[model samples]
Target: MSETLTPERVRADVAELLGCEPAEITPGENLFDRGLDSMRVMILVERWRAAGAASLEFPDLAECPELGHWTALLTGDGA
Candidate 1:
């Protein structure tokens, strides 16, 4: 079975995976420009896929490419 996708969990994972503080990930923060590299993005993608379909990936994660995007993904809203 797959783990559930929860907003709090997602935010925590994103923070850990990107080496950022939770507060650094506001709703409109930009991962790339803010310091998220392609390599890190790839790692995040892989982790997401391994986590099952409930995980978010690159393209889908690229919509806003900001904190808001990540916030939306974790909250079950966004594309």
Candidate 2:
């Protein structure tokens, strides 16, 4: 289930988990500050891993709870 990881995609996924509209999720906003909990983060991690992002880890998302950062990390465009 490999697919391109884009900021839009990340935003959509995060929005789904957070029960908000994608437009409400800012690319640079901190997801944790927006109510993203550990359970949701793990759910996202598993989903991404299943989508071929095996390198993804909880801390990778936790340390940086921004959509842009997650997109870059999953897409291999950021550190």
Candidate 3:
């Protein structure tokens, strides 16, 4: 949200919530496998929506659960 809805910002936001560095969040990695739960995903959905990603939804993320996919979805670069 600090910088526009970019992929990097998405990574940083997810990283912050996961309690790790942005670099640790590989784009193709499964966030759920990295400890991201539905509650946290919902938290991110609300946060990203507030930051202008109004179309983002929990099901959109839950169906994929990958950082790259989420980044793209939030940044308008993917489905």
Q: TM-score for all predictions?
A: 0.70, 0.86, 0.88
Judged by whole-model lDDT over C-alpha atoms, candidate 3 comes out at: 0.86
Model 2, residue 32: displacement in angstroms? 0.8
Residues 12-58, model 3: lDDT tens digits: 88999999999988778889999999999899998888888787888
Q: Output the worst ten-in-a-row residue range by lDDT, candidate 1.
A: 70-79
- Report the Cα lDDT for residue 13, model 2: 87
- Cα lDDT tens digits, model 2, 1-79, are 4775666667788999999999887678998899999999999999889878888899999998988789888875542
After superposition on all CA atoms, how large is the RMSD of candidate 3? 2.5
**Stretches > 4 Å off in candidate 3:** 1-3, 77-79
Better of 1 and 2 by TM-score: 2
Query: Whose lDDT is higher: candidate 1's or candidate 2's?
Result: 2
- In Å, residue 57's CA in model 3 sits off its true spot by 1.1
Off by over 4 Å in 1: 54-57, 74-79
Best candidate per TM-score, number?
Answer: 3
Per-candidate local distance difference test = 0.66, 0.84, 0.86
